[model samples]
Target: MVAHSAAKKDTGGGRESGSDAWKNYMRRQTITINYGRELPLAQGVEFKI
Candidate 1:
């Protein structure tokens, strides 16, 4: 699992003194597998390790 944060700022026109700030949060997941031997992977089929 991974966590990420992003911030954005927008400056207004026409006599605006301050800027608008926005934040975004996101999460992601990744999976990894280790194999002992090299084998061919077939689509729509399960292989036993």
Candidate 2:
């Protein structure tokens, strides 16, 4: 499951050194991915967004 929370301000280091600092400084977001009817199970499983 995806959990949404606020993002912390990054000091910039490690793997994220060259990455956009704005991405880290931005607030958290919630994205709901829909797999639709492509899943094999009756309850819908294994499908991806």
Provide backbone clash counts, one per model. 0, 0
What TM-score does structure 1 among the candidates reach?
0.15
lDDT of 2 by residue, 1-49 (tens): 1111222224333345424444543422212222233333446344354
Estimate, for each residue in 5-46, the C-alpha lDDT of model 1 and write its tens digit.
Answer: 122223223223222211111111111222222234545556
- Candidate RMSDs in Å, in order, are 13.0, 9.0
Tell me the TM-score of each prediction against the true structure: 0.15, 0.16
The true-versus-predicted C-alpha distance at residue 22 of model 1, in Å, is 64
Number of backbone clashes in candidate 1 = 0
Task: List the pairs of residues colliding in candidate 2.
Answer: none
